[model samples]
Target: MKIYNTLSGRKEEFAPADGKTVKMYVCGVTPYAPAHVGHAMSYTFFDAVRRYLEFLGYSVVHVQNFTDIDDKIIERAARAEVDPAKLAERYIAEFYDEMDSLNIRRASLYPRATEELPTIVDMIQGLIDKGYAYPANGDVYFRVRKKDGYGSLARRTLEGMLAGARIEPSSHKEHPMDFALWKGAKKGEPEWPSPWGPGRPGWHIECSAMCHHHLGETIDIHGGGQDLIFPHHENEIAQSESYTGAKPFVRFWMHNGLVQLGEEKMSKSLGILVTVKDALQKFSPDALRLFFLSSYYRSPLKFSEESVEAAERGAQRLRSAASIEGQGTGPDLDSDPYRRRFVEAMDDDFNTPQAIAALFDLARQVNRAFDEGRRFDEAQSTLRELAEVLGLTLRGLESGTQADIAPFVDLLVEMRGELRKAKQFELADSIRARLQALGVTVEDTAQGGRWRKG
Candidate 1:
């Protein structure tokens, strides 16, 4: 299979470091607040990477980390009058709820920064002992000058980085380019006892330590948002290789494109953000997932209500087609066109757009079979396998909601219709409010109102 390697800036054939076993690590969240659509776009991209590898019959071991102790966590905790650790825990639970609603597969190991303090401190001390890092006033900083080929990932020189001031000046560092390995404990912040003094791991060091601890010194894939390609991933390569003496810290580096809001990055600081919980209230979770898959993983995804609505319409078409060919018997093991098309698309750098197009192709065949009054067992099975590869569900292409909410929504819809026909606008609005309160949404259309589960 061909996968894009961010370090090389080219698509390369993928081969597991160990035979038939793939180990991957992607950066997780700091958990200060509710996750937004941008966060959804980030994790959803990596989840596709893991799912596709497993679909190829490789034993995949995926690990993601929780940055439980950070400045954001501490600051937010102080404002909320709760412990920083408790704040992290609450948001971590919310993260899982968001991921589960979107059908993300859980990672093999979900390591938290607090739980891996020993590993982090040991790694930091190794850097210090080897002369690659130094202690300055209870803080440890990596000596960027000591590591040769330091800017290979960012393709930058120390001179250029300094000129650009990407490497900001630090009074205590041996050089301005050097980054912190361990941060000194501050008032009202979490800390661990370390050789350098009681302190916390730097942002970059936490990821390197966590990745090495979970996936080893060398692993098949290391991935995160494209923003990490610079100081974050570059510094990771330097410290990890210097400590382990490994040639390459990660064999293949995969970076998903940035999530964009017009010309700007989506940010809570700017107030132009939508929370996952709120967005899911207006649209199906599958719609957002499909919107992400519609673009190549390595391309910028622009967010706007109109664009999201467009994605929703396209996803509805695909889901509608699959529902038409509900449950059926298995297909013949051979001569499965859907299987061939999907594998071919995935093999070519995980081109999901092509794979989705193939689904429509199969939808045509299923439609023809339905018109002929023929059993579509083969077509049905093909749709199931292919959709699984794409991490999508047809949800009974030809069926209705089977959950307990189905009956409740059906009753509410009838009541809403009667109230509307009576021209009791106030009563109809009240019924709609009641349905929404029950986590059921009612939508009015030319054909009248219909309700769906929240």
Candidate 2:
């Protein structure tokens, strides 16, 4: 397999340090509010990475972290009159709900900042003791220039970063690029005992510490949205390598592109939002998952009602083809070619849009074979198997409320067929019209009447 490595700025042959296991860590959310589609796109991209790796016979130990404490979390918690920790807990649960609705596989571990306090404090002190970080007024800041190759991952020199002034000047810091390792505690906020009095870990340090504590000093893969590349991930590289004395903190830095809303990025600060909960209500798990896969993982995905509708229509084609009634008759269709195409597409830096195109190719052949009174179970199963690698489910009803109503629709279609056999035209037509109104297509087949939900 070959994947683009942000660290090297090129697509490189992919393998783990051990050549057997993949230690993958993707940045998780702060959980300050409901997760939006942009968040869905981010996590879903990484989830596909994990799933695709495991499909190739490699053991993948995936760890995603939660920023249980943050300025945003504290501010939002204060506004809601709830404890910051409690607020984090609430949205953390909601994150699971959104991911589950999207059929995202749970990571091996979801370590929270609150739970990894000791690990955070120990790493900060290690940096301080090594002269890479210092304690100032109960706050600890990393000496960015003290660490060689600090901006290598992002491919910027210390002088260039300073010129850009990506980090605002702080009077206590020795340089403009220096970032916090541990923040000083304030009133009415969470804190822990550290070498520098009592304080919490900085936004970037929490991820570095969580990775070391969970994955190890050096990991196979580190992934997040593209927006985190500059300061957030660059800072992670500086502190982690400095603390562990490792040459490369992460083997491959895979950053997925952002999901956009028109001209602007889909972000809370932009005041443009579409919650995953609300999206799940309007679309199926396959539809949403397919919508994301329709675009390359590293390309910006645009959101539109028409685009989502088109994905649902494409999902329906797969569903409709699989639902065609038939019995095994003629020769079994060869599916190996389709499988090879899918694997090849994904193997080339996880080109998911190309892989999805291959899936639809298989789906078309399945439907064509059934039309000839010849069934190919192998072909249908191949389509399902390839879809599984992309974390998409083809056989189920649309997730959420529609999933609950599927059986009833099937039953009513069956009853309506019975009424058609009994020559009850009026009642049969009434049932058919109602099903059509609900976007369910009831087709009369020679085998019997079959139905599909749009």
Candidate 3:
């Protein structure tokens, strides 16, 4: 299979370095708040990659790390008046719920930064001993110049990066581009005892340390959002390769483009994002997955109601095609060509848009064959199998029977009524709006709020 390597800046044939299991490490979320659709988009792409790799008969050991302790986590925890650990735990649980609801496969291991502190400190000390890092005040900074080809991943020299970068000068840092390995403890923040004073791991180093401790010194794939190309991923290459003495820390670097909202990229820091929980209330798991896959993984996808609504309709079409029980006793519909088309599209750097087009074409033929009194059972099965490779569970409209979701909808309607009685009109209205957006109409009678699926 051909996959795009961001480091190489081109598509390359994919094969496991060990010629067996694929060790994939994806950068997980910093669980300061609930995950947004942008998070869904990133993970969904990686999940599809993993699913496809496994479908090709290669076992994939995927490890995704949680930035459980970071500046954002500490700050959000402080504002919420809770311990950082507790705050991260809350959001981590929420993350699992939303991801599971979206039908994303769980990673093999989810190592948290706080839990991997010992490995982090050990790696930091190794870098310092190798003259690749130095202790500054109570912090340790990676020497950007010590590593040859420092900016190879990002394809820029240290000098070129500094020209356009706005780096804050620090007295302890030897160079402005030097990134921290271990940060010094502040007055109010989580701290861990390290060779350098009590402090937590820096943003970039946590990922390196996690990869080393979980996946090993070198991994097959290191994937994350494109925004992390510089500084974050570049520094990972330098420190990881420096400490492990491995030429390449990651064999393939896969990055997905950001999800955009109006004009700006959907970001937690910018507070311009729609939460996955809120989105799930308004769209099915199949619809969300189809919407994300409609665009190429490397292309920035604009999140819009119209696009998602259209995807929902497309998903319904696939569902109808797949559920068709053919009664014809004639010859079976030829599905090998559609399967070949899917494999070809996927082989060309996981061209999912083309693969999906193949599925729709196959679905169209299945519908036509069903009408023509020809056997279509195998074609329906083929459609379902290929869709599963993309993590699309064509399990009816909303992933379950109305009876299965009725209790949850009823519970939400009841909660909305309670919110209205408590004078939380805004929250109540929001629930109503979200339910309406999901095609459920709520009627407010003198008795209470009643809901019916449209």
Alpha-carbon lDDT, every model? 0.82, 0.88, 0.91
Error of 1 at 91 (Å): 0.7
Clash counts for the predictions, in order: 4, 0, 0
Candidate 3 residue spans exceeding 4 A from truth: 398-454
Residue range with the least summed lDDT across 10 consecutive positions in model 1? 326-335
Highest lDDT, which number? 3
Candidates ranked by TM-score: 2, 3, 1
Q: Following a full C-alpha superposition, what root-mean-square deviation does model 1 have from the true structure? A: 5.7
- Model 1, CA-based lDDT: 0.82
- Give one digit per residue, the lDDT tens place, for model 3 in 1-454: 9999998899999999988899999999999988999999999999999999998999999999999988888888888799999999999999998999899999999999888889999999999999999999999999988999999888998788789767778999999899999999998777999878999999999899988888887899999999999878999999999999987899999999999998889989989999999888888889999999989999999999888999988998898788766348878899999999999999988899999999999999999998888998888999999999999998864425445667898899999999999999999999999999987878786668776554
Error of 3 at 429 (Å): 33
Best by TM-score: 2
Instruction: List the candidate 1 regions with Cα displacement exceeding 4 Å.
Output: 325-335, 396-454
lDDT of 2 by residue, 171-280 (tens): 98887778888899998788888878888889999899999998999999999999899889999998899999996899999999888888778897666878899888
RMSD in order of candidates: 5.7, 2.1, 8.9
TM-score, prediction 1: 0.86
User: For each candidate, what TM-score against the reference?
Assistant: 0.86, 0.95, 0.89
Segments in model 2 whose C-alpha atoms lie over 4 Å from true places: 165-167, 398-427
